[model samples]
Target: ITDWKLQKEGGAWNHCSSSVNHGYLRAVIIALYKKGFTGKDIAASKIASKSTIYRIIKNFKESGSIVVKKASGRPRKSSKRQDRLLKLIQLRDRGTTSTELAQEWQQAGVRASARTLRRRLLEDGLVSRRAAKKPLFSRKNIRDRLIFCKRYRDWTAEDWGKVIFSDESPFRLFGASGKKLVRRRQGGRYHQSCVMPTVKHPETIHVWGCFSTKGMGSLTILPKNTAMNKDGTNTSSESNFSQPSRNSLVTNNAFSSMMEHLAIRQN
Candidate 1:
């Protein structure tokens, strides 16, 4: 007590550094008691509160140890097995929302709130994020794509040079590549729900063009009501060709110009 020091700041005593270790506190209390110091005197030394001093002395006397025993609290709502089941449910359908997952989990005998489910998923390293947007492909489309790939698999670049590649694409004015959120682990980018299927016909303007290995072609912007013919023929003058009398069957000015340009370039 005689060698004790306290820090002073702003003309006031700050007792922040006065906190001592539990074992050191117990030893100090015991030492003071053995030295015939009363509780008030021991507390006056500014070592600890009178309550803490008394509690430490009582603990040491009754339990022969100043260490506090552990106390049990509320248990977890979910068990390990239930946690694993929750992970499986999420993996089954990564696009399922928390509420939807909760409903599905009810069938599996686990009752938990959406918030709790999210917490459990986070613990298992599963994150809910916007799913990647991908073009919707039907079974027929997939089969056709496979066949096309197989058919062209052996074609060399020179062989492909003879073929003309043409397509019409609609450019959207206010289109957003929005995505859906899904729960998935790392390296699950290509998972079923993670790859969003899109089937949207957004408001756009159709632009037609064609290209070959030798040269490129002019782009023709079609009118709003222009319906492109499937048999390489223009349906009407609404297609806005440069000349409708140049050829009756093939009236696509862009396609004709592309052929003429490619022919000149080839010569």
Candidate 2:
């Protein structure tokens, strides 16, 4: 058997220069052999087996170079066209899914799997998919908005500010909070029982208020007993305070109360 010391020493010269020491292993073997080092001594260096060292020496005698043959493996799948197509898909359809883009590419004469498209898109610094935000309004909504703007063009800033804006909005105590893609399982209903805000008729009270830039006025929570007339008049059957139910009386009382409060604060 070859010794470890010779093999280790032989490997040092073998690893040094690939250009100058092109047949380095064979040169080491010959050099060591001439220097009174046996084949067992060369094998002991652990660089190569004794048989491998002999084979290298024989091969060098026949061929000029000690370079190993190139390896053979599966060729790369993507061509330049495929790479360009991936970049094009990434640039054009930023938030589109890989599956959707793959289908699109197939239609455009490039057949690729979703996995392939996903990998390529990732390599090209593009995400496979993303959440698409829901638009706040549509074309009809935009048209109605423009019409409202045009109609309110004559109103002054103070006039607009004096006009109190109030709208009813529903709030659920336990509602799902985000926009997410929901997938229905096998034999399962598409709808899940999530808390939805709802208002029962007669249970909900009507709230109205008026305000100006200077101050806010009293907010009125109208009871079900109060009747609203077609002429935009409030009529109550009974009065808690010593005030008349007539519209003029109510208006005058409210104006006097507001003015008196303002005067008292000003003093």
Per TM-score, the best of the predicted structures is: 1
Where does candidate 2 stray beyond 4 Å?
Answer: 1-46, 49-75, 87-96, 100-113, 136-138, 149-160, 173-267
Model 2, span 1-267: residue lDDT tens: 244345446766567676555455556666666677666776777556779877765664566545555678766456777778768876885777777888887776767788877777777677644565533556765555455556656878756544433222232334334445556666655445333344444243454443335344455556543423323323221232223223222232233334444443466
> Each candidate: what lDDT?
0.65, 0.54
Q: What TM-scores do the predictions have?
A: 0.56, 0.38
Per-candidate RMSD, Å: 12.6, 13.5
Model 1 TM-score on a 0 to 1 scale: 0.56
lDDT of 1 by residue, 70-177 (tens): 767777778898889999989988999999988887788877899999999999999989886544557765555555556656879766665555567666544445
lDDT of 2: 0.54
